[model samples]
Target: MRASASWAIRAVIAVTTVSVVAACGSGNDDGTSASPADGQKLSVVATTPEVADFVRNVGGDGVQVTQLIKPNVDPHEYEPTPADIQAIGTASVVVKNGVGMEKWLDQTIDAAGFDGTVVDTSQGVTLRKGDPDDEEMAEGDPHIWHNPLNAKIMAENIEKAFVAADSGRADTYRKNYRDYAAKLDALDAENTKKFDALPADQRKLVTNHDAFGYYIDRYRLEFVGSVIPSMDTSAELSASQLTDLVAKIKATGTKAIFSESSLPPKSAEAIAQQAGVKVVGGEDALYGDSLGTEGTPQGTYIGAEEHNTDTIVKALGG
Candidate 1:
């Protein structure tokens, strides 16, 4: 929630600048036109702060980055405005989650005819389907960043895209990717140890929505069910659905009813209260579709995951 309001203000500034220079092509979203080899900071745009954080880690000081989605906003149902369109149009490189997650982005970018490098982080990673047979993740799940391994893959792709966009910084991008990938590997190992301590049954989670499929899949935990069945947080839970979810929680003896900060906790809390379960606190608000406040633990992808892992281990393992 920290970066969201500030980011919105910055977005307004960026969008205003885009409106003035949309037709001029002043070096995409970053405001730099020099080629990557010329050592000029590359202008880059990513759909989410997580992506932007990855870019910053890999791009380092050599790249200028802009993130479209702010912290604590549900990206599943986010709508782009005229200013957003301008920002997209003016971007030289666009990195998006790309698994039909941001439904509005493709249409918006295509409609604007924004001709720039587009990188889909979901590329190449095998997707886990929510419904298993749901046509949405037939190719691969777009939520690739959910797992650290998948995040490493995203880092590699970001490197490739940065190289393509700015050939001069190819070496810088490659080194950055390698360093960041190593950091992610360490994080993965650490989280693996944390999650490994839990009894298998205690790992079950019933949540506000289907946001943690990848996290559950990665740690070998059971995703008992969701307060809302769909991947979209904007969807409301029905009375029947709430009753059913509560029934499941009671049946499974679910230890925690989880909620993301971006989404309403009322429904999940209601379910928790009904189930007579203690509401688990301190789980870093899961960055399902966005990042967190800058400088906070959830501000970056690694930081967000670290927050999530600590919270999950405590909530479920305890």
Candidate 2:
């Protein structure tokens, strides 16, 4: 009986020693347990759908990106959710389309306690002056990505940030940026050729809001006016302002009123009816503030720009 009890005690000690060894092997040298996501990839957070797309193109397999604002959501009035804050808190980098575009971002970052690298994609691009009357856009227009040239600059900025964060993947990020930048250049050239082929009068645009200033300036197109006078969608249109826009549309002989995917088309439709022009809505609406759903043609930055060009060209008799 004594011999049997001693064997039993030895067996218990052996099992406990093995369990402790296994647990120690599972942890790091510092004694903290390993997480599933540890050393997987660099975690990134993008503010908008467009910025997210840019980051994906640049980062490729090197990053796991969390897009804060989903497609078809208005960024001008977007409020961050708890999930967004959490993601920001854990991200190693946050890429934003700066220039007063993300009004809620500063406070959101503060709330998240994020001390990560923040990449403002609009750092080097020349900004278009916003409507002085509107406080939201008093500094400058934040729609710089509409022009593919500006997008190239933004992509370069993103690539630099990625390299700074993860120097080991610098070559991968640079190669990806070059490939995407070439594609952007090709798109820009193609659109410029297409628009240049049309008469100057056919290049006039009347959009839902002042979200395409860079695009208009890039293509040398005349901006008739926006249904919403202010760059912000939250601004209400006064009765006189609406009447004046209708008159301007009629006076300029605008071909069609292009509604935005992120905004309500009712105002554009009303204005178009008053001005005796068709309103481009539904699937044909321009992606002013966001892209289409993922996996669709219009879901990507290039695809959305191509769609916008085609829609505008067809509507304007080009």
Candidate 3:
């Protein structure tokens, strides 16, 4: 009877140990814990590189950011992979550059079965209406971050979301947002002074796509036209459109055709050649759709905007 009781006790201990192990392993299928461990950084998934940068700045060391879209990749044409969906599934919050930028976002979220808080950074910022003719951008231009003031709104939205998701770190997030906002203000002021110094005619811009509307509007520069003719890079240019753009470039006396880092420069180069204008390709391409490589100066939002300003100013004879 003593041996039998001892055996029963051992069996109970084994069952309890197994139960504990199973409970610990029964997290999301993506290998993430069902909930963040105490003191663990909040898991965040940002739909785009720029959005990821904003989250990083606002969340600071309090969040682990997973950027769905890679750097230098066009967000307009990006298709989320299984890994991206899994990341979203396990994330505590998802941040996006709303205004129809991520057309695939809703479906991707559904597929991920995510029930996390979503932060749309474009909220409260004034939106620019797109060309009514283009179906993709007929709603509105989604690239609001090009304007520094608009970016401030985005950062504010991010900070709020971060605080809501992790209220324990609210102070840290707010402080980071304020610090980043100051940097953005300084960047805007410096760029404004430099751009205002240039003649209005010399501020004309021709780019690979209609991605710089906010930038142009913010700095009061004239946009001659774009190679793609639409805000979305996935849009194709027809023969007639190409010919008309070349004509417009010549008529506007646009000095340079600026290609985007995320797009193919062949089209811009061809148009520039036809229009007899210099094409800023290769390293000098603008970071319109995406940021530069991680760990580089242009990888950050401020760095990319500065590069764009310097490139445009130099190319446009500023």
Candidate 4:
């Protein structure tokens, strides 16, 4: 089997069991959730913490969200455990960052016989195609959350899902969606303001992987290169590929590159060493795949974007 295949199998151990916290009470020892008090809140199952944050923002007290992946977990390499499968089976709705982001979702849902409403948050957002030669998806790119505008699109989808699950709360859900949309608009403007101040040449971004295409496109920045040229971090690079990347960096005079907190920075450090430049240092690395660990500034979507924008501005010498 290929290494990616093994990655899927190994990822099952990453999450031991479903954490079924009661909406009214506390967590259960077994992998079963307690019912909501008076059954007021909608039980929502979101795939990532980032999406779960969105649900909280929009759903408010009307929703009780259960996230499958923990903080700093990479969805690309994540495989659902039996507990996670059980959790989704009990949810009224499931929100996914769809455009091939969750390759394991279908199989897991099938095993659980889940018949809930699935909201693909990537709907109506323009997507960047993967490399024509990529084995997994030559026409799909799953990293949609990098662009704040795309978050607006996703937010709408999330709200729609919540409303659909509980039509009586449609008015409430729409109001919350509008409020959250304003926040995303503010974030987009904030980042664009900083990015627009930078010199066009300095907008070149090199990073651990070929992520951030949406953000780059939105800000009119350039994605110069990456140490790993694929969206999946589990993919490896040949020595020749790294050498070529180093040469590209030297030629482009790319000042600073970055890595993510979720993914290792070893390849980035190697490229920086060969190119004679420094990898970006910060309170947190970038938060492309997962948000920061819990209880930090970068733990939330907005906070992570703030950290990422600051890092990019400082690295690009804006």
Candidate 5:
């Protein structure tokens, strides 16, 4: 009778322990769940390298981020493969630049049955209206991170998502966010000073596309026109549109025609030639859609922003 009693007690204890263990590792209420490899840290997936970097800055050592898109691969035209879905299959959190940047994100995550919170960094950002010519951007611009002020806002949103998913380290996440935001604030101030030095009329920009609305608008520069009337590089340009752009460039007295690093510059260069303006591109090309390759100068968000400022200043007669 004593032996039987001891055996029964042990069985109940085992079952209780198993239940607690399963509950600890189970998914969260917000649809996030992950079997952590080392029984610690969240598996996070970011839709773009920019958002991936933001997650890194905010999550610090508490997360392992998987970037959905790579360098030079335009997210606007990206199509997720089976491997991409499988790579993010086990994520506890997924971050995205949600002003319609990653159109494939929701569908892919839903289809893959991703059980995680999709954090949209653009939640608090004041988005610019899409280029008048691009019907696809009826929702607004997705390049919120282009403006340094918006970058600060994105950091806060990302921090909130991190805390929600890993409340155990809420303090650490908040501290990290504060540190990252300080850097963004300093960058914004620096860019503000640089742009302030340029005369208002000289601040006008003629770029590869209409992607600089937030950026130029922030710095008080007039977005005189673009080589492509659309915010997206993939948009087709008619001869009449090109001619009108040339006319606008000449009328605005725009000194330089800026072509994006991620897009083909042949059209911009042709426009520059036609308008007799300098083409500021190549290494000096502004990182419009994607960041630079990892480890390169412009691979980082700050580096990319600084590059754009310096390149534009030099080209536009800073």
Candidate 6:
């Protein structure tokens, strides 16, 4: 009887040990069932796909990112769905473009009462004001990524956010950010050199909207005018405004009328026809509202900037 009792005790100990080991390695040692690390991934959520790509570039291993906005969706008009709210609520870190770029985030998080670190990638960059023509812009223009310099700043901010969120992998985030920022710096230098070769007067740009303010401001190029009277493309331009913009383009001797890839090209085409100038579609149908489809040239931020630089330089005769 004593021998049998001892064997039973030993069997209980073995079961307990196995249970403990499984509990430690099975990813949910914590009481919270939906804890992020259970999947061995850093739970990250971003407002835009562009920001998601940036986070993936830096967060690397142990990170799973979800972009709130899909490709080709306008950030200006994105509304948070029930699924998006749940995603945001459960994320360990939420990265946003901020500067009013993700207009829905503020209210969504407020309503949900989320406590995760909200990283605004646009932090530290001086935001440009909206054009007088942009009626939808009640405040400043929030499209800072158009400038390579701002891209560098945003990459740094993402690095800091990732480090803060997961201190164990801080070094990985720092290295990735540094490497990407170096590439941005090189791109900036290349753009500056190429644009510098163009005559000051020839550096003027006309676009479908006022999305190019940051790009123009960074490069010291003149924003001659936009075809649309508002920053949000949902708004329509008046005939008087188009007539005035056409005259302004002619007056400035602008070389090209640049349109966005997502917007209807007819408006810009009409403007180009009225102004008697070339419509630079291929390169100038740029990534603004959303990036290109993955594996394409403008899919990534670096690729988009490169594509823009090549287009502008070619159009400007640099």
Q: After superposition, how far is residue 204 of candidate 3 from its true place, in Å?
A: 0.7
The residue pairs in collision within model 4 are none
What's model 2's lDDT at 5? Answer: 37
Off by over 4 Å in 4: 1-39
Q: Identify the runs in model 5 with alpha carbons over 4 angstroms from their true place.
A: 1-39, 131-135
Q: Count the backbone clashes (under 3 Å) in each candidate.
A: 4, 0, 0, 0, 1, 1
Local distance difference test scores for all models: 0.74, 0.84, 0.84, 0.78, 0.78, 0.74
- Candidate 6 overall Cα lDDT vs. reference? 0.74
By TM-score, how accurate is candidate 6? 0.83
TM-score of 3: 0.88
lDDT tens digits, residue span 1-318, model 6: 124533543443443433333323211334222334444777888888778878888888768888888877777666666556666666767889876676556656544435667888988988787645544465578788888888888878988877766777778889998888888889899888988988887888888777877888788898888877666776677889889989998887888988777677898999899899988775467776678877887888888877777788788774
Tell me how candidate 5 scores on lDDT.
0.78
lDDT of 4 by residue, 119-169 (tens): 889889888987665666565787888888888889899987777667777
Model 2, range 1-318, lDDT digits (tens) per residue?
Answer: 124533543443443433333322322355332222445777889999999999999999989999989999998877666667667766778899998888777766655656667899999999999878777677799899999999999999999998877777889999999999999999999999989888998888999898999999999999988988777777778999999999988898888999999999998888888889999999999999999999999999999999999899988984
Residue 249 C-alpha lDDT in model 1:
87
Per-residue lDDT of model 1, residues 133-166, tens digit only:
4454444456668899989888888888888778
Give the distance in Å from residue 136's predicted Cα in candidate 5 to where it truly belongs. Answer: 3.3
Where does model 3 exceed 4 Å of error?
Answer: 1-37
Model with the higher lDDT, candidate 1 or 4: 4
RMSD to the native, candidate 1? 5.4
**For every model shown, what is its TM-score relative to the native structure?**
0.86, 0.87, 0.88, 0.88, 0.88, 0.83
